[model samples]
Target chain A: MRTYLDCYPCFLNQALRAARIATDDEAKIKRVLDEVGMMLKEIPLDSTPPESGRLIYRKISEITENIDPYRKIKKESTEKALSLYPYLKSRVVASNDRLLMAIRIAIAGNVIDFGANWGFDWDTEVADTLEKEFALFDYDKFREKLDTAQKIVYLGDNAGECVFDKILIEEMKKPVVYVVRGAPIINDATRADAVQAGIDKVATIVSSGTDAPGTILDTCSTEFKALFHNSDFIISKGQGNYEALSHTSASRLIFFLLKVKCRVLARNIGVEEGGIVIQAGRDR
Target chain B: MRTYLDCYPCFLNQALRAARIATDDEAKIKRVLDEVGMMLKEIPLDSTPPESGRLIYRKISEITENIDPYRKIKKESTEKALSLYPYLKSRVVASNDRLLMAIRIAIAGNVIDFGANWGFDWDTEVADTLEKEFALFDYDKFREKLDTAQKIVYLGDNAGECVFDKILIEEMKKPVVYVVRGAPIINDATRADAVQAGIDKVATIVSSGTDAPGTILDTCSTEFKALFHNSDFIISKGQGNYEALSHTSASRLIFFLLKVKCRVLARNIGVEEGGIVIQAGRDR
Candidate 1:
């Protein structure tokens, strides 16, 4: 992804602010400013935007000086998701068919995400539509299916979404493993963050092995492969996971995410912008 | 400065490597590995030592990520001086002294920073010594025989070493107007560093309205001030300029820069380390 010229000033502003905090001397400040000015003059700004929504999303994350604003928004989004817990719970209880029950469990698992407006939301909306599309879904069957699952892997997204994932895990009434993206990028949930959020108590949190949203089979470790092979269902969150794994032959991998506008995705899914998209492996 | 444990993995290695062009996949590799296992948990058996010395310095300047590293270093250091070309040249040559003829005019305007090291080769041994014992000097000869007829305003240091004022600017051989601390907290340059640097070009670069390095004398414009005032010489740089006149000074101000060990400055200086200084000024 290329950074545009418009963002160059922001970088300068951040750098200057950092310099100010570092020193309070007139000579030091002047020197630093001069160097910065020269740097600005030298580096050519990239005008091109990224090809993938994931790249754009990551760039936005990198460009922000303080993570507080994003954290606050993520918290709000989590609260919204938590508030919908009753609806999610009721939907699970009302589902009758085993497939519908599995889908609901996958959807609930999908709550873990980086938490932003993008194509993943569209996937959730699709999950929501599935309840209306099928008549066999009932709450008891969903509960029964969740209870019997051998293992469940919940992929986490952004910071606040981890909070929501925690809530969802508690409501699952089944043994589940929470998966974090590991070190793919800055500010993503780590084992430390998961522990800080008290997620360690409810589910075993593991690394997905790649920063991209999709499951790149080759990148997976022996432990991850074992877990994937043994799990009854895989719930992947966000566009990154989808991009990496959507074309794979993995049968149980279910992607839930909102759609950000991207030409490739729009063409593939026959949708102009990202929204809820849920594809059972056979559909692809 | 002591780096934190958390900073070691990213800052010492990955981030540092990314600053050089040798490995484009540094961040990507870290990200991929991080996804599979916690970054901290997957410590490498053989970690490579950072490339040090002048070559590392030169290469770092060419890469973008090195900017942050330089900023970090700047934050850790004390005092910085920026010396860009034209402004420094004009200030030195303005006196029209015969000794000024020896200076390399082509490179005369090239920036020469003191203190903080940049990713380039520059001497620091002299600057470091001056930073420590700056207060033990008496300038009775320069002070008693000073001429106010020149209307030169000598710039003073608000913080750190005032050595440059004594050594460099004093060599210009002009009767300098010295400015001292007025309401400020500590010692500021009163023609000290200029004397030390053997500068004879300064008529005066000092405080009239305020002890602040770049304080603007707002009471009179060019018309009223020029009648009473002689040809004004403004030679000031560093933090004082940033604080007092970066925004509002009316006089033609010369600014010198040096990359310092400060995050804020490193970011502003737009370099990975220190040494490089810039000089710029407003044309009156």
Candidate 2:
């Protein structure tokens, strides 16, 4: 989706958050804000928010001289989510509809995101996601695609969310290629984060070759692009990837599984903020 | 009173809000954000937020070419508050501690502020403020100072809030020099707004000379500075005045009557966010 006017303030807020995580020195933090503020002047409104997010994170890293600012947070999130893995798996196993339960569990994990600026109440979020009705539940299409698909491409979002994604990937019962960012950006999963979440055990983890929090096809590695294009069944995860791929009209059926986080994204997707969506295919 | 790191993002948010109020053009709104972002680079940490707030609003005016963006909202707020005046006055009159009730009403009015970024629920806020316990209630000190004080300098806050202040001024039964902004800034009360709220009938309305949201002393008119300095009793209303004057080492007994609005101000005053404070004098 194209960047909205509301995204401008959010961009600065996210920048400030990353800066604080990267450094304790107030001077350095101020410098990061100043640089990022100036950077906003050049950002185009037509580009997806994640495209600009890439630059903001890069600037933060440069100013604070602390690469991978969310590294500690990512590790903590992974460990915490790993502890809940068994419980999550049990819910999926005990459910009448295992696939739907796993999908809910994955969307519930989307709350762990740091970039969304929403508070996380892990227990409540899990319960609520399991009980709450989806804004768009394209379950029949999802089941049909999964039934016929041989190779599934699963797009990974954040670190902790990878464990949740693992549950869904297992439920898919097919050969899956899990995609992660090439490098660190916010708490977005890299190869290491996915490995920590045991995603590597369930599926092959591939880098999208862009350190961006989302999958911008133009910036993706040739191999990952090939895999994305070749697969007829794709499960796009979280706001970032959804933003980058939401409007793409590639010859594939993509299912977006996420908890709507912001007003702009919610408006674009025709969902209420904090609502879940199991959407099928590209939206014009 | 110094600008907190947290205030930087808030500054941009406020600028965007003011910009949206000023114009419907998306490009103009973007320009406002871009300009405000660039302006943050020069804002010093030691300066009061209102000092930078002055610049942000000025930039909005320059870019949008709408000097008084909140004029219509200010008028609407005045009309809304005026309608509540009779009921509010009746509550004060029925209370045994009329002054204290009046003070609560004034603080309740503080919630009408547009700059705080908090949602408004007029009926609920009035009822809650009347019923809630004050975080810092210096009632005895407030009464003691007001008892012997000859002249009072009451720093006016937002436009609609002036009507609430009028009730308190009536209870004061002393000559009140109601201070207002020299020019339009945010929803801050100016001479015209105060008059619209019938403040002219109750108190002597005067301009502070500074168009900043708060009473920034250095930028005030010589007349206002004299009035502020000479008065032994001063009633400073809302977060803006508290932020600007919280640390001022003036030779006067100032009572800060405000509903705690933001985290930074809440920390500075040792009050929790969303709580009421009737604090007397400055803190080191």
Task: Evaluate every candidate with DockQ and list the scores.
Answer: 0.01, 0.80
Which candidate's TM-score is highest? 2
Clashes of 2: 0
- Per-residue lDDT over B1-284 for candidate 2, one digit per residue giving the tens place of the 0 to 100 score: 89988898999888888898899999999999888889889998999988899888999999999999989999999999999999999999999999999999999999998886556888998889999999998899889988998888899999999999999999989988999999999999999999999999988898999989999899899988888887889989998898888888862368899999899888877879989989887545
**DockQ score of candidate 2?**
0.80
What RMSD does each model have against the real structure?
19.1, 1.4
The residue-by-residue lDDT of candidate 1 on A1-284, one tens digit each, is 13322223333333334334344453443343334333333333221111222232333334433222234434454555556555555655676743444454444434444322232453456355444343222344334545667777766655444544565576665677887754534234556556656678889889866543345556566787788777766555444455555555663344343333344445544555433445443334
Per prediction, fnat is 0.00, 0.61
> For this target, which candidate reaches the highest lDDT against the unseen true structure?
2
Worst-scoring 10-residue span by lDDT in model 1 chain A: A45-54
* Residue B200 lDDT in candidate 2: 95
lDDT of residue B129 for candidate 2 = 94
| Position A30, candidate 1: lDDT | 37
Off by over 4 Å in 1: A1-149, A163-173, A184-188, A192-201, A230-232, A251-263, A271-274, A282-284, B1-284
* Deviating ranges (above 4 Å) for candidate 2: none
